[model samples]
Target: MSTGPAGHVARSTIRPHSETGVEGRKGPLRTFLSTWDGVRIDSVYEPGAVVYEESGTRSGRPGSPSGRDGLVFVVAHGFTGDADRPHVRRVARVLAGYGAVVTFSFRGHGASGGRSTVGDREVLDLAAVVDWARGLGHTRVAVVGFSMGGSVVLRYAALSRVGGGAGTGGGEVLGAGVDAVVSVSAPARWYYRGTAPMRRLHWLVTRPAGRLVGRYGLRTRIHHRDWDPVPLSPVEAVPRIAPTPLLIVHGDRDGYFPLDHPRMLAAAAGEHGELWVEPDMGHAENAAPEALLRRIGEWVVGRAG
Candidate 1:
């Protein structure tokens, strides 16, 4: 593990190997899903120990709490992260304690076929996974995203409400809607180069040599084209996500966007959103502690109603 841009530890592609994945009763359910733009996404479904029975129905275990039944959490990883990333699997395992979790690789990451669009069109990748979660009989769905993914979830939720779950290129985005949304270590606006890490990240995304490094060194594929028309920023999308439970989490010591980012999102959220300013924390999922993840799981169970 290497020290992240700020204070926290950021595990690049070179980290100690962790367990293969979190396994359900029948083992990890893995598959490929197609996004609205026809990009194939690699997805994994892990059932909560207390959430689902062998038949995929609610277990109703003796001490299981209410509101957990039929609930599914769709986890969206940060840039260069895929469903199988050790950090992502750790998050899935913790969230699975409360409900089933559906995690997927965006267009250009993991085994999925396509190049990364950074954050612009990744909404389609999330939409495909959310729809798949619904198809699995989950009545309540919550989306949890980190970093770049955080931006995508915000945009996705807003688009779901405003566009009625519509997709581009004539592809029907029937499953784009979600019941709850969580954005962690996300930026409020786009094109922010306020920090060193972000500046390096921008270089990695915009330059040809950077793309090569992302592909060979980081095992992530990035698209060369830029966003034709910049999508709505996270702050702009927050107000539109109202009526749906939205949670914005940021660390006081975050390396990327400072406290202003989350604060901006909270201000936009008004009464419709909740914010958690973590103490002594750094950046995205790599820095999110297990206890915090559990608290987030609890929030999902309680709010996804």
Candidate 2:
């Protein structure tokens, strides 16, 4: 356990059993750590529990591989979201049904330090969380991100393959590589403010008065500088994620980003990726239905295992 800025206590622990002990239920271990760039990140680890044991292997889809022993999911929340948000927790809980789960808050959101560079600098935060998951003894790690986080996961997966020292702040070490990636409701390009919600979001990050609201009201601090060389767009990063399984999920009814966004990403991903155009779903984590989330969980378990 350690103390972070503003006296936030970050601790890591693994419990063997829950108080109720509902047969095979287990507890989650949480910790707070810093990225290579020195940004604090709040994280949680949910140990895989045995929902049903049969023939020395857990049950799963017929003809599919069983025994999800080493799979772990690192879930990154959308804009204005954190590890503790109900929607984030819901996604974590669903993923936890299959294997271990890791959920975290990006810097400038929740209790972490530094300002949100939106999707640009958030890749470092996901890298750090993935590193921590690897350190926790999980051999196969998958990254799942929503909205802004969706873009971050795509970029992280792409950047991580270009060797080890690109985005980790000047010679700093790179985190472990991700085995699978799931991006929900992400933008293919940058500076998109076509929808009302996105226009409002743009105002929140670009305007001084809106940034004040972001800092105090939303608990998210916005960085003022523009992208120096213009970070890779999600579409540009998708092709680089090849050989590694990629899943791009978006809602047909999403008001924030239209179908064109996911379509663009899926096209760039080529044969290495799968696309799910959800029916009647809205935006990001909040709008994702439980059924859709379960499908996503199943997808991660199948691929990451």
Candidate 3:
């Protein structure tokens, strides 16, 4: 097992990729694919391609060397966020403590390459991460997302179906494995949300350059159509993830989306899903102590089911 930054430990199977896709040998463009079999990662936050299984090791009782191997957790940060955002970093650390080596950086965020698709195009990036994880010999994998990242993660889990999501479908699944997901502060629907920084932030972004880049990429239109105000809300997409366990986490104090949204999703999930509202958690950030993180880890790692 290799250690991620900050002494994080995980199963060292998949490697980070150089580019966003097109895995192969390293070239000047290796910044886009994989140099080592497509799953070996070169960096953790930069636009990455592959990731190894992260089974973080924790320090047990002073004399005990035995420790639990953690679940592989993929964390997706919100728009304008990177793997290093204080909140993202904190989430990574929390998951790492539960035996997870988390990795995530949506398009246009962090060191990842490409323009922001808001959440649509970012779904492709999540797909790539999941593919790389499967290559590393893991059957059960879990995902955690925050804010816009939450949308991307939900979309990915849904799209992975043979046909639930529109674009590239038929993602790798363990026949039933890789069935857990958690979305924190995810908008029930992104076509438009209430009055908050979400819309303002999208309008505030400089997208002319993103448009230019999208022209060469496969799914460029997502950025242009992101705010169209017609797509199904996250609640609409919840049904697609059935059979696979889901957890919707929202902060009661969130300013971006309503706290009831997650509860609404949980209600829909019924026995296969759950919803947790942090009394003091804010938009895209969870500040709860060990109690919340522990339960979250258990839920997403397949223990809750």
Estimate, for each residue in 174-281, the C-alpha lDDT of model 1 and write its tens digit: 344888899999999999999999999999999999999999999999989877667678998888787889999999999999999999999999998999999999
* Clashing residue pairs, backbone N/CA/C < 3 A, model 2: none
Can you write out model 2's per-residue Cα lDDT over 175-201, one digit (the tens) per residue?
Answer: 566889999999999999899999999
Instruction: Report the alpha-carbon TM-score of model 2 versus the true structure.
Output: 0.84
TM-score of each: 0.84, 0.84, 0.67
Residue 271, model 2: lDDT of 90
Instruction: Give the candidate order by descending lDDT.
Output: 1, 2, 3
What lDDT would candidate 3 get against the real structure? 0.55
lDDT of 2 at 152: 92
CA lDDT scores, all candidates in order: 0.79, 0.77, 0.55
The candidate scoring highest on lDDT is 1
Output the better candidate (2/3) by TM-score. 2
